[model samples]
Target: MCGIVGAVAQRNIVPILLEGLKRLEYRGYDSCGVAVNNGGLKRARSVSRVAELERQVDDSGFAGNTGIAHTRWATHGVPATNNAHPHFSARDGEQRIGLVHNGIIENYEEIRTELKALGYVFESQTDTEAIAHLVNHMYDGDLLSTVQKAVKRLHGAFAIAVFAKDEPQRIVGARLGCPLIVGLCDNENFLASDAMALAGSTDQIIYLEEGDVVDVRLDGVRIYDRDDQPVERRVQTVQAYSGAIELGPYRHYMQKEIFEQPRAISDTLEGVLGFAPDLFGPKAQDVFADIDSVLILACGTSYYSGMTAKYWLESLANLPTSVEIASEYRYRKPAVNPKALVVVISQSGETADTLAALKYAKELGHRHSLSICNVGTSAMVRETELSYLTRAGAEIGVASTKAFTTQLTALFLLTATLAKMRGKLDAEAEAFYLKSLRHLPTALQSVLALEPHIIAWSEAFARKENALFLGRGLHYPIALEGALKLKEISYIHAEAYPAGELKHGPLALVTEEMPVVTVAPNDTLIEKLKSNMQEVRARGGQLYVFADGDSQMSSSEGIHVIRLPEHYGLLSPILHVVPLQLLAYHTALARGTDVDKPRNLAKSVTVE
Candidate 1:
């Protein structure tokens, strides 16, 4: 993933560009740079943070009213000063054109070969440099037309911002697969890959559709379609609070976000006073009546959320549900049920594979679509007919915490709504569910109080090389999520398995050196789960269980149990995951790993 920001204003905008890049640091970046047309194109690039790039800009005395900046997550080349963004194209000895890009150019090899044959020597090993060279070769004096023609020949997902020395008062941007937006102002205009980058500067934002080009000028902005037709896009007011970007007292954003779950889940469930068929949207009743099956599309933690919902949907809503990994779902030719509702779940709402999977399902004539996402301006929300916005605010940590729980809250609501539509939820049941929903924040508070105990467990986990997580039925997804979190941040080898499947294959790997973490809520499967625990004990496997208070589990011998405040019967997963999250957080903290920005992982997966 990468970030782009461009501005054309009356005053020097290098500070604005740098600030925008700083806001985009959450998206993850390997290198960063900025290009400003001060008399000529003055650019500075560094394979470091935006702060380092800011110091370089200050030292170089680079100032201009029109400019473009980029924070790149390298895909095509190694992250170096030469491979950084704001790549320059020189004619003779002067830098004539500058370009910054997000996403990959798939056919850059062919284009690079052609440009090489034309005697355009390349200076960097990047697909973006190919675009810079191609644009410089096709500069017909009009920056907009030149970019439009050049992009017509390119392939794959790209959001590009290009500026020329001759057109110092303007910046041209084009988008295909990746996201791009235009920010409106009185005497200035802005372009960025995300609207959050423009939150403090402008509230009025225009989300550009696919294959749209925009010419940002000092006075106004012009939008064009793919076929050279001028178009008007609706400018929506972004209601994001920029204060959420700050880390107040918490050690890391992940810690702050973990504590924010109470408010985030409360916000996500604010409008729902009681369970109704229309809780998701106006068409939920009809969609539920028409579809007898559900197809959930998601990735990473979102996919696990979908998997948890599958249990809820089949049991509570009485609907047949199937969950698929979005990346694999799009590529495989699977059976498409015409009466199935395709539910897409994503925290960013811009996950490339999940979006493609949604589109692919629609292309197969499965028309019913819904998205449970946090961002309202994301492509998943824009493309889907039915949408639920999870008010989790902005999740900056690479290992998502609040976003995951808030999404689970939304998915549970969706399940209850569908159940009410199918007459499976009576008045008494609906009232119980509503009370549970209303009490989630309080339940989460009780769980957060157990952080000290979980931190003790994490002390033992931090020194371990491998771990095993076990659960049955509904809690199985929670175990998977716990394993994912431990591996993501702590870099420990972890795996999860259904308790009944221990004898299948995973039991062979159990040892005294490995810790076994179990989600042991009081449920129908508790007896079987206890039997599974005995098997683990027989093999000398140390056990760490987050059990319900009424589960009668104790801390003895090889078994270590942290009892829950109470067993929250259908909503137990929501509370059970909190301790596991704290476990992962404290474990990573003890290991001295980068808890916020995990290595080789970005917060948002914007590209496939």
Candidate 2:
């Protein structure tokens, strides 16, 4: 969960690498370092921001034609300078083979033991150091082959960018599970863990798949598969903008992203909008005709979107649908037919568990797999046979708001198309939901206007340490998402219970200090959610209710009611999620936490 970027630029590579690292800081910010070899051997490392690291390089007058850098989120040790990356191994672990790693190393213990046995003492607690030594152990001084052999001994999800002293002109990168992008420029080339890392430099990028190793030099790059066979891949055009990924005009990335929802929703609806009436050109249903069931595997907010999709697919498409948390889905044997169609939903497309679940589904003999993801060139999209891309541009916030809504929007459209195929829906029922879905952006805009109200209520939450979110039916997933967003950003101990499951165990935790959020919008499940709220209220838990504006439920004396616009059938979750997103954002902001680059958290989890 770190950001790694390397560049061989026409100009001084240090400045370009620093610019890229600054853009990619949202991925990680614990520490930053860079190593560039211009005319001679020069190394720059620092314990602070990328700017400070750049300043150190400038002060030392270190310049290089080729370089690799890392912005870190510490997982192995304290977020200190010693633990920072660009760990070099030459004479006495000084500056020999410069290495920066982005994923976890699972075999670090065993490798560390062996390295110790080989008289290699470690500098930092990072698993990456072992890799630096492993490369040294494997390098019979061949930069490319050494990296290949070094990667062969390592296991886990990792994207490593290495620069050797001998091969000052070359940078070798290897991908095990983490996402990697190699971009082309006029007389220059770049390597990043994600396409967004190089969003400013180029739009054409070649996405590296699992077990792909690339040797990048001044003018060319060669990719090799796991078995050492040379492979050729194409550069795909990526849709990205300089400002879309920039930290424009906002106090924090979470806040900037929350306000970007209106535009994000619109962007996600592009191309697919105004075409749902003629969507998929009448052959859409036939495309999914062989499907028996849809097993949606996702994690976090994407999992909640899958939950809502399950309701839509079964209710609209009349197909049996099962939504599973990607973390738990593979542990148990699932009841699915060989003809079952598995749909994996992920925003980053590199979510570790969701990607694993997709692979597990394929191993189960599912003939077809589809990925519903926002990012265009994510591992999830590349690995799946059929896929639907949600045009929700780069979602940087760790607490996913727009991506979840967009994924739901795409899945809802898919449900409608399938319903039309199964002959389950005629004109009336079909047009109603699709038209309602098209208006979701406007409805979501209406909900976005409630941000100030949610922010006001957030003041009461900044002091609370725990929160309970409750909803039933479709709203249950909304509750889960709310809880997730709150916990992810605010660091609050939040829990979501299936309203019915309150009495089972969660009710015992209710207290005056614990804020209980009830998603009680006027739906068939309102009364049920109300009963759950009463259970919490009777137990002295602070109640904060988000209900429909049209509902006559009088505002409780002490409880906060975040009034919602008139409730629509299925678009309610899409609209209701806005306030929760704002609540989490404002709450985290109030706490003065690093809301965007939370500790030990990266935007994309490329490793399982």
Candidate 3:
């Protein structure tokens, strides 16, 4: 994945390009570059951060209305200054154009061979550079027509921005299977990989649909179909605190996001409880009021949210519910029907595989699809007939924190509403679940106050190369999420196993060097998980556990404990996940790894 941003402003372009690249650095940071057309065309590249690119541009003082910049993630070429993007091509004596591209071109090899056959010499080892050359070769003196034709010949996922020498007044942008957004301003126009890049400059934007191209300039903005006919679209305003994108006073985004969970939960619950006609537990039952089956699909941490929801859906709703990882859902032909409700869960709402599964399900004739997503106006939100919003704000961290809890919160509320609709909930039953649900915000506050302990424990995991996590029932899926977070950010080799399955195969990996993290709360699985913890100790495996505060513990057993609050029920997984998130964040911090932008990991996966 890579980040692309372009600004054709009324004033200097270098400053806006620089600031925009820095804002998009989360999408990619391996290398960066910028191309500008002042009096003459100039391009700058850097192997380090965006600052180096800015420095070179400042030294050259290249400024123009039409310019393109890129923060590259190094997919096709090595991470080096030369491989950095805003790639360019010149016709030796006639024309030149700079290009910044996102997404992989699967047929680049074939196109490269064809270009060479036509006697065109190549420079860099990038699929994007080929795009510039192809545009130049196919140009008939019209930038828009040339780009439209060249893009028609290309195949695979790509979103590209082009700045031409002859067309100095306008910027050309197009997308197919990758993300691109056009931001409109009174005196300028912009094309960026995402709306966040244009946050300071403009809030009104039109998301470029697949196979669509746009020419943006100070005087006008025009969209065209693949056939080059001009089309019109209404612009939508972005909804977010412009300041929320900034780090504020925090040292890192992970820490800032962790502290924001209290408010994030509240915001998600805002207008949900009273004013929104029971968003948490309402309308869900109406849709599934007579349904006899349920299927949910999700990926990564969101999958854990689905797994927790499965438990509540089965217990509370008394419905046969199944949760499948998106990838696996495809290979196995699961039972489905018009009466079944399919749920898709994602934080960014752009996860490639999950979106694909949702699309596939829709094509297979399941129209009653529901999506639980954090971001509004996402493709997933648009695809689903029904959507539940998660209150977590912009999550810059590659590993999610607040989004996970909020998804579980929404899922649990759905379950309660389903149970109420199914006539399974009595007043006492409703009151019990509702009271526990109400106490969650305070419970989260308590867990957040325990951060000092998490920070201390992180020191051990920072040096640890391998670890294992264990849980059962709802927490089993959360255990998997915990291990994934550790492996993703901290670079620790970690695995998760159900406590009951310890004797199967994973138990063999148990050693004193491997810390066995058991998510043991005072639930039905407590006794069984305690037995599993002892089995690990018998094998000289060190134990680190999150146990209920009132649970019994023995110092002789050497089971280090993280005392949790008193609300242990179906909703406990939501709380149990907080420590693991903290542990993973602090551990990655101690290891000195990039917590917000993990290597080879993008904040949002927009391509399959």
TM-score of each: 0.98, 0.94, 0.94
Superior by TM-score: candidate 1 or candidate 2: 1
Q: Model 3's lDDT to the true fold?
A: 0.82
Give the alpha carbon lDDT tens digit for every residue of 280-389 in model 1.
67977787789989999999999999999999999999999999999999999998898999999999999999999999999999979999999988999989978999
Best by TM-score: 1
Q: For model 1, where is the 10-residue window of minimal lDDT?
A: 275-284
TM-score of 3: 0.94
Candidate 1 clashes: the total is 0
Write model 3 residue lDDT over 281-313, tens digit each, in one string. Answer: 345446665467778999888888898888888
Models sorted by lDDT, best on top: 1, 3, 2
TM-score of model 2 vs. true structure: 0.94
**What is every candidate's alpha-carbon RMSD to the true fold?**
1.2, 2.4, 2.3
- Rank candidates, TM-score, best first: 1, 3, 2
Q: Which one is best on lDDT? A: 1
